[model samples]
Target: MHVFEGLEQRIQFMVLEVAKQVDETLRVLISPDEANIEKVTSRDDYIDNFKSVIENACFSRLHGQSHLDKAGIDFIRAVNIISNNLERISDFSVDIARQVQYLSDQRFLDQFEYRPFFRQILGALDIVVRALFHRDLSLALRICRAEFILDKLYKHNFDKIITRLQTGKEAQNLITTLFIFRYLERMGDSLLNIGEAVIFSVVGEKLKINQYQALRDSLDSLGVDLPLREVDFESIWGTRSGCRIGKVSGDNKGDSTGVIFKEGKHKKIFQEKINIHEWETILPGLTPKVFGFQESRGNASILLEFLTGCTFQEIVFNEDKEFFEDAFFLVQETAAMIWQKTLKAQPVPCSFIAQLSKRIEDVFVTHPEFNTPQVQFCNLMIPSTSELLEQLQQVELEVTAPFTVFIHGDYNSNNILYNQKEQRIHYIDVHRSTHGDYVQDVSVFLVSNFRLPIFDRIVRCKLNQVSLHYLHFARQFAQEYHDTTFEIRLALGLIRSFITSTRFELNEEFAGSMFIRGVYLMELVLAHQGRPWEAFRLPDRILRYRYY
Candidate 1:
């Protein structure tokens, strides 16, 4: 039987109950009779009971014997969310009705246009059943827009109440009236949530209304001619950057390869768009081609050509020895070509410590124990996190890259994709691509590989080998370029990457290992401060995973 066979009618009944409560609450505001107040408050229990019953049914279907398709699952989820929000609206109505009791005069609310608030809320509520059941995008948009309109109404009434309160003529009445309007505004908020739940059901992804609109605008700007309801959105999780990334494809089309839709702060998305263009100029086909970009208010969205290939992380974990080696060779070759083409003979001061400082707070937020105080260990004085960073910052000023090259700001393994058939490597997230020290990329790449949580001995061994191989290649490049402080600079870069990388890792043993490696590197650099930097050696043991 249908996934939501019994549940859909119950949710519709619940919505109707909430709408009636709101209607009674509005009448109580217009004329606060005891009976109207009692009617609004007493029915809240029925609405609450309806919510429980619907919620239990939704969960039961979810955990039932029959398997549900993605659409069925999404519908159940949307139904549950919609029911919860409808219950909230009912509660808010009771709250509004209670506030009417404090009004010194019921007509005090009449001075303000409160009917439009009810009209907006009730009109939106009238469509909840139809919009959610039909999966109608236009109806969902209408429901979402009611929140914006109600917000405007609330603001207008709020200003009027503030002005009247300044007169001290009816301060209590004005405040009580404001409370009623606030509850109405909150009811509008519930409508927005209900509308977004419907959108989620239609799209099979949880997207805020603004994000959905941005995606639609981005697609329209590209002349994609696809409706929002007809598109499939598959969320790309595992990112800490607070950006919404998804793979979008036309649901009706079988041949669509899909495109990457990214939405975030305008500054970041815009910078990425600019950076992609720069990469195209420096090396065509190195980055994904931007299909369209749209910025509205403070947020932006971009549609990018989705690169079809396995990420470098996938190859390292799943591919055979020959395939992994071939991919690694391609990575090395790509780096060499990009660095050679974009190299600028200008000394850029190392900002490893500075970058570390920016993210150290985040590290401490995740692993507070990493922020230790100075400790005594035999004859040596171990530095605290702060003390180590301060010393590194002082020494970092003296070191600089002899030449600058365009580097991927985030050189993680997953960000680099390799297409075996075409034998090509493409960069996916190019927001941080710019002219900078090459060691930045090198250090980040090594740490990214080391930070993978794979514990299998064979995979870990491969990771260790690849990290050392890449390090050797970077050292060779530095030597050829005559970067005098290459070793010291790389040590600083590694220290920065290793320390910040721990913030994303939650495994205590693994995170502590990375943190200790960073501290050890710091001590090594600090000890060699007065000596010649070239003689300093990077211990490979710190990079390798050792079994106890």
Candidate 2:
């Protein structure tokens, strides 16, 4: 048998041994005894020895061979990462034991709520062990998710300690326990890193385990072993915040799966699931089939059917001028069709005004600098973002929809894909699809065309024309259906687009233009706040809304 034959089993055994030590340390953590501390401390030596053995074995194997395949290297990396994490976890257990030795009274440990933290870490360690050996991406995701659970548990317990301190609890006892929790939480983090490395060894996705699990769940229903293309780190947009989008090239030409990873307060993942449900269950083939999703730990991910074609954004910016009108019309027509889509569910009041209100509220809170009177849109005087929202509240919005229809909550051009050859319009990012006002769809359609970040003066003029034309088209459609509030509604939609889009616009000048355009729409709405909905006029067109 080769040395590499039992390598995984050896690594697994080493990890299990450290886990045993962690359990012993945790046992002593609840009760302070000099002998128990010595035992836990001694376990760290064995843990360190195993770590060194694994490290040396990995290096020796690598140095002994001139050309190792990607799988061999990745396996070595995974083993090393797991060893390092297990060693750190053992070290943390010893640290916990040391902190326990500092305790003047063992009663404080009993007073604390640490069972959950211990349970989570141990559970995570077990999951990692299984996932590492079996290469179960799903179990890896659970291990990754467990770290998040433990971190939150740590924070909750930390707050309890601080609150106890503020109330005059003994600092020494509480501080010692706090250090133990901190060490355990750090161990959880190390375990999560290990899970990532393990998944990378198997999948080569280079993302965390939760992300890998999302992909696994997404593909489970597809029933294909389609080769996953390399994800370019540079191509993954918005790495820090909001929705992170990535593409893996598909087997068929022009077909590539799109990935959306979002983190933080907002939960768009659930909404996207509903959207795909509508597409697959209610309106098949109009939108891409969603494979699956995972929403946890304040993060959400969506795996979407690869819709191949130029996005309307790409078409508007890169395609020739002759295709512009067709692109705009097709996208608008698709939005109209989505609006005309019917289902039996009870429809809610139109959320156009409600969405704008929420987005503007978020704008003021996140980008307070946009709340000044210094902003302008083509000589249009604009005040604070909050003031604009107030004016919107004062306006009498017609909540009763002219016709309740399924609308893409975010009907931006970026989300619209057109395949001219197939004469099909494909929609992406449908997290906001809902039964709402068609006017909302039209409104989003208009501003999405206007907010292209290109700096070319000619392109700006052309974009403005497309937006204005689409507005008229929407108005004409609304008039045909006896919905007379298209003008006012579009203004409200522009405000949502201009303000909310700033979250994505990185260019200083371009973001400023979006803000100004949004403010100008606010000014337009306020100018005609009390007027009849039919009497509202469109704002002056943008000539130079571009990035430098």
Best by lDDT: 1
Give the alpha carbon lDDT tens digit for every residue of 1-548 in model 2.
15465567678788789878888877897666888889989978888998888898899888997778877888788889888988988989888888886788887789876877777778878766667765555566567666766765687678889999997868999898899899988988887888788767666557644443354333322221111211111112123222255666766787766654432222666676777788665556767766657766655555666566777766776557667667667777766665555622343444455666666644543344565754688987656566667657667345345566777766666667788777778876677787776667666666666655455777677777777677667767777677656566666666776677664343446677788877777776777655576787666454234452
Clashes of each: 0, 0
Each candidate structure's TM-score, on Cα atoms with residue i matched to residue i, is 0.60, 0.52
Instruction: Find the number of clashing residue pairs for candidate 2.
Output: 0
**lDDT (CA) per prediction:** 0.80, 0.67
The digit string of per-residue lDDT tens for model 1 on 1-548 reads 25566997898898888889989988898889999999998999999999999999988888894768888988999999999999999999889888888987777776888887888889999998877885555577668867866776787778888988889898888888888889999998899999999978877777686633354444333322222211222123101112334455545775665567766557778988999999999889989889899998876778888778887877888658788888999999999999999999998998999999998976775566788999999998877889989988999988878899999887878778888898989986777888999999998889988877678999999999999999899888888888778788888988998898876564678889899999889999898888877677888677787642
Least accurate stretch of 10 residues (summed lDDT) in model 1? 232-241
Global Cα lDDT for candidate 2: 0.67
